[model samples]
Target chain A: MFDTQSANFDVQGLSVALIQAELGRREGGIPIGSALISPLDPDVGTEEVPASGRIYIHGHGRNQRLQKSSAILHAEMDALEKAGRLAPEVYKKATMFTTLRFASYVHKCMCTGAILLYGIPRVVIGENTNFKGEEDLLRSRGVEVVVLDNQRCKELMREFIRYHPEEWDEDVGGSKETSARAS
Target chain B: MFDTQSANFDVQGLSVALIQAELGRREGGIPIGSALISPLDPDVGTEEVPASGRIYIHGHGRNQRLQKSSAILHAEMDALEKAGRLAPEVYKKATMFTTLRFASYVHKCMCTGAILLYGIPRVVIGENTNFKGEEDLLRSRGVEVVVLDNQRCKELMREFIRYHPEEWDEDVGGSKETSARAS
Candidate 1:
């Protein structure tokens, strides 16, 4: 059901590029983005981030446009913002996914957006790459994780770069967040 | 949005008795049960359960059933059955959830059905009572869980036994598996 290539060894990665390619839509300059977050994710909990918390590559969307499959992730972002670890404003209307790698520009942007918004220096997946419970385990230590498998985690950095032009340049307000926003 | 008691620290648990009290009905001596499982949990891979892996109380459902406000907790049952861990017949007509304790009876039955049908000997919550990721952590080992907070985990062994009358009596066709069929 996860639409995996090999369900045994794979999961579909919710990459930023994939979102950019699949969900990043512009209707008369009004961009419609979708986000998903787990309610249980520690990153979205309204608690303090343990000073030494782990990271996971995250892709976020607005709650207004968040997907049902992504509730936990949306919540994760909520937690990140509620806690002083992340700036509150940028994520106020966002949805997100946490993976181990910054697979694409959109992915990087989302992660960057988290860093900028959360004010955290970085996002890191926990110590074990394949440990699926890393998010839950980390969330316990105040570490949140959203496990990504190869099927869901295809590398799509180029697609993200190819599709998103407005936010690519800093001088032209090419900020990832700015470019992602449509009028 | 999660139907939690207080956005600060609570989620409502759905149990069978509660469901019996809330949604169950005796229609010609046959009880009507409806369950909704999420589509994105890691346990039910739609392939094979990794042997010697992990267990999480998976409450999987078809993604087609997922909504923006809910995460993947609903689909835990489908995964278990699909993996052949649970007999096909058991879940073909059933659905499931991933919360540790059922606030309602129907929720518990579906989850309990998943365990009994899957051939798992028992459902063990990890040692840590407050660990949220125990389901994900345990599901990785092939066991699925629904984390129970103090309010919901009110030792429902009696309630579980009471509602599941057919499965409780080891002497009178009380097998958890034998008692689930409704005629």
Candidate 2:
């Protein structure tokens, strides 16, 4: 149902990412989303982009309860899995669009490792989260990284955190015993 | 068979983490590995730790080719998944031991998110990879983290990178076209 024929891949990809984030919120999951677009052929000419030349795969982060393995399912990982299944050959040429800015090494290593393994060439994120050399690392590895701020995507993440106060609480030291007792 | 009776939990946990890393290397996967030990009951007394008071679960990173969904499975995620299935009740009290030092946010966010969600209290890594505030984030969330360097674990990871040079190559720009042509 998406406009696959659009030459503006970024526009289409961001729209898909936003929709997926909203869907995740509605499904009681993390409000993070990713959209991966298969590479466009250089020989095809950029004027009239053919729908067949590109594939769109979108995914949203899932809560631990919704996962069969009870592991946190990340939006980028979900989209990457789907892309791998749908198109392995052109997957490496894919451009990934994500709704959140990564701020931790765990997320950077895991997702960057996958992106590099699959040879994804470009990544677009919604806003910056004080990225510290992560963008440089990606660039060094030949990944074109872009940060494009989106108001709606920011609002969705804010809402998700608002709803899940316990999960995001920073006063974790005082609550450790409480959590242990509750468990 | 591991000596689970050892009162030194760190020694036992590190040994398990190392073994898992070796297993991954032998299985043609990533050399990273993780071990999760369920918390010892507070009343059990630390001097003579009972076997029934704790549980150990270990896992290794898997290659994308080995996965049904083609997702790159991190050692931490693998261990977390197994712990969730084996013992959901006491999983919150788990202490995670990992063979590698994470250097990216992808790994940090994914692994940290799961740890927080499960209410895991402690984490131990083999070394530090110039972590930038990620450790602080974890500590702020009430997680205790320790870095204990190990020679064999470092050797295993080095060998993994040596064997898979293309995967870790920093000059990814020149190879993009070549990869596209080969595909």
Candidate 3:
């Protein structure tokens, strides 16, 4: 069983990520979303915490305009970029929460280097998949990994696949292009 | 023994990459460099081929300005970005050349996902290292990988280490930050 009461787990951060994922899906973008919560966040009584030490960011997948091949930006990258820009100091002490497993997310877009570069210590994710090897790689690099397996997160991923079947397939199995396609 | 005379080998592209790497090192940037050559490039007689279908790009490692954590850009990503912006159609059919082996390069910066996203067919690199697993992963994804043990490339990497020992260590081992540092 998963321990939601773990001291390192941020339930509120996961809640915010779910909201961001739903918003992204409704906006016709990739449903992936990320949140970075600093340990300095002021503890509020209710579930609605102020946005002082929490950052929510989301983005679409590959840019079709760039010949449908450029994964111009991604949600996790966006969160890291924004947090790095906004509060560089606070984010270093931050815990990352996302709708997808961090390993799967990094595997899909290759942001593992950036995450390691940023020195993010802990990651709390909502889904789990066959990316256990990638997760182990991250762990070996010293980043703490946690999976929540939230039901809403799974639903959002399912919905994202239903809406963008082709992209989901390409994302799961890295895009394979034949030499003839280059001509 | 490495086959320099292979039909797919681009000796000229590797030569250009060496020039780029040297220039980058002299400019106080990371010595890594990347070149993307399109199959449609016009064959020139001499080693000095025109830059019509070849794009050379290089960059520094982590942006120290961003609290010494953000890997703002990298050579391979820069080459891909520039090529994707300049000739989106042509880049899809392009082969990448770099001073560092592609697997080591991607492992250092996590650009594997971007390379796969861009649908590049082949990669020709100068140096090879312990990133054989990463190289095999790329091969499994259908990208052709080649290693050319160019002496100049190895010299440049050694020089880069002599100049930026700390960064080189961080790049290879991946930055490991303790929770205390984050505070």
Strongest candidate by lDDT: 2
Off by over 4 Å in 3: A1-8, A16-27, A36-72, A82-94, A102-109, A112-121, A129-144, A169-183, B1-9, B15-23, B36-72, B83-94, B102-109, B113-121, B129-143, B173-183
Worst lDDT window (10 residues) for model 3 chain A? A174-183
Backbone clash tally for model 3?
Answer: 0
What lDDT score is found at residue A109 in candidate 2? Answer: 33
Task: Candidate 3: give the clashing pairs.
Answer: none
Cα lDDT tens digits, model 3, A35-122, are: 7666443223234434443343322222122133433345565565444343333345567777776333443345665565556678
- Top-down lDDT ranking: 2, 3, 1
lDDT of 1 by residue, B1-183 (tens): 222223421122234212322222221111212233222234233364433222222332221111222111222322332332222222322224332332111211223322332233223221123222213422444444433343323333334345655322221112234233220
Writing each residue's lDDT as its tens digit, candidate 2 over B1-183 gives 333455667767877878877877777766677877764442233254445644545343432323333343557767755544333234455678888755322222345555654567788887554233343556776778877878887787667666765443221212434223222
lDDT score, residue A21, model 3? 78
lDDT (Cα, tens digit) per residue for candidate 1, span A37-151? 2212234433644233223223344211123222122222323322322223223322344332321112112223222222232222211222222123223323233443433
DockQ, ranked from best to worst: 3, 2, 1
lDDT of 2 by residue, A1-183 (tens): 434456666767877877777877777766677877764442333254445644545333422323343343467766755543433335455677888765311222345555654567788887554343343555676678877878887787667556664443211212444323222
- Candidate that scores best on DockQ: 3
lDDT of 3 by residue, B154-173 (tens): 78766766666555544433
